[model samples]
Target: MAKILKSTDLECFQQQGYVRIPEAFSPVDALAMQDFIWDKLEEKCSILRSEPNTWDKHVTGLNKSAENTIYSDIASQRMCRAIDDLLGEGTWEIPKKWGSFLVSFPQKLNHNWTVPTNHCNGIPWHWDG
Candidate 1:
């Protein structure tokens, strides 16, 4: 099979510690993921996707649904191939399901955004750790 990630993608990963693979999954799959997340948000956090005013938090986690197939839907073979390209075939085991994904919601309030000069300054912007 043809490589899903190119040489430049590998180089970028080497230099920047990450890479982007476009269309790794279909739009339908993405929508499904979004719907699942929104449902979780409403169920756990009382945040409704239909109401923009309720988007209070920048990050909300959905951790409990680890065995759902929605994860597998988003984890397309293209994405797996990209991973294999980077890490080598059979080097890593892809989880059947994912636990604890954070959805970064856009704040309804407006504010000036700037790049953080230091680690401590970047507290507002963080990963799903």
Candidate 2:
């Protein structure tokens, strides 16, 4: 059985259209998962390095092979718990398009990176969807 979300959590999600789960997973657990992902990535890199011609069929941007494992055991458990908590039992469904993970490396900016702006057309537009 999962813990029930508080009234405040429901209200916040309704108002903002998204809710942040603070400290949902421990820092230690997160770092361990990250290390696991890096290990898989390194293995893929090594395989590509050893066989140059196989690169065309296997490697993509950042050497990320399409078939490479994305979700770790810990991550899968966390996501399952989150889904159960948010939507109740049997409500979770696999998404048609599972997204890719991105890691942005910091580099010295050549120009002032202005924050992109967009207008929020709130609930009326959202409800119409």
Candidate 3:
């Protein structure tokens, strides 16, 4: 059922533990979702995309809106197939709604931000797999 039926992709997944699937969903849909997130960030955290000074925090958290149906289109059939390829059939559960969104910003030089020397100090380094 996987769109990436080719073994090369599977080999990449096996070796790297992740594979990128291009154009799983429409680009316009992705942009819409991005705009929605930016709007929420500005609304909730006052983190304006237009202002770089507002982007102080390295990471920001935002809650997902249940009423918005735009998030639903992200998980296309192609994406599901890719998931199936990686995780195997019926091994994964489709999300009912997007729970949370974490936005990461670049650390500004002016900010008193110290790079984490140890793993547990700040953002812990780890692989997804």
Candidate 4:
């Protein structure tokens, strides 16, 4: 059964350009997904889960072409329902209609880096739709 959205969900999406569903995915499920992504990354990029030093970029999952909708076979039901409720029934499609799986692995291990504070407040060109 699809989970119905509260009025606040709609309001938040309208105001913030995004809606966050709490407790939609369990921590165990999330870890499983991360494991799945890691497997794919290792398969495609040869980056082993034990070796974090090999993980150069943030991306770990496949780019997922628009022509293929096979990923639906693996998508979580909760996610599909949430997207459908938020966007509309049958609105959730593959990369062509919806979007790709952007699995980003955060690099948190101790490293010499500094957050850049000086910046011109503007949309990054990559996101300048």
Candidate 5:
């Protein structure tokens, strides 16, 4: 969380249809995630973190780990404010924990199978209210 979201940022998101918030997450906290990922990789396979050459095959699935140890300090208050501005005040709901994670592999799978597509056409869009 840094500066407040100005009208310019909202305008850019409306015109360009996207906004990039650099360094939203803490780099120092995120750096530790490398070790957590490596530890999980080692549990499934014999590939060591030091030996990158051994990590040739890509994993199709992964074991679920506690969000506390895996994704610490990932929430960005700056991002939340920006989203709130776009969606309306108090519209964005901060969850108690991480949810709805769908990690697509580098290899191609199904074409249509994915998260809900929002082309902003006649799609059924509404709030939980």
Candidate 6:
């Protein structure tokens, strides 16, 4: 059965770029997913040590993991459902640009290292330009 998102959920998603769907996954499920990703990272490490050329060829290790990971179950189901509700079914087939989910680990900075200035890439200016 498909879970119906409430009006509040829609409003929150509209105002903010994203919204947190509470209790979307059980604690056990979330932990399992974390373990799954960690296992993939370990596999990547092992592969890289055995075959350094493979690592160089593929910058992101996600492709290997994506194939092994079960999208039908776990976290992906919730994301797919939300996307369907917001964009309508089969919207994924449409050619969209600049949409991705990224996860990064924060690194501790040394005394000698200073914070670097970063800028957001602006959208293409049509009328002004």
> TM-score, each model?
0.77, 0.48, 0.73, 0.53, 0.52, 0.52
What's the true lDDT of residue 5 in model 2?
Answer: 58
Residues 15-118 of candidate 3: C-alpha lDDT, one tens digit per residue: 88777788877898889888998888888778898998898865444654644787787688888888887778899988888565557776657667764555
Better of 4 and 6 by TM-score: 4
| Candidate whose TM-score is highest | 1
The residue pairs found clashing in candidate 3 are none
**Model 4 — which ten-residue stretch has the worst lDDT?**
120-129
Candidate 2 lDDT, tens digit per residue, 75-124? 44555566576687688675533444443324356798754453365423
List the candidate 3 regions with Cα displacement exceeding 4 Å.
Answer: 64-67, 110-118, 121-124, 127-129
Q: How are the candidates ranked when ordered by lDDT, highest leading?
A: 1, 3, 4, 5, 6, 2
Report the lDDT of model 6 for residue 50.
45
Q: What is the C-alpha RMSD of each candidate to the true structure, in Å?
A: 3.4, 8.8, 3.6, 5.5, 7.4, 8.5
TM-score of candidate 4 relative to the true fold: 0.53
Residue 72, candidate 3: alpha-carbon lDDT: 85
Instruction: Tell me how many residue pairs clash in candidate 2.
Output: 0
Instruction: Compute the lDDT for candidate 5.
Output: 0.59
Candidate 6 residue-wise lDDT at 36 = 65
Clash pairs, model 5 backbone: none
Q: What ranges in model 2 sit over 4 Å off?
A: 2-4, 22-29, 40-79, 93-100, 118-129
* lDDT-superior candidate, 2 or 5: 5
Give the lDDT of residue 105 in candidate 1: 62
Superposed Cα deviation of residue 34, candidate 1 (Å): 1.0
Quick one: best lDDT, which candidate? 1
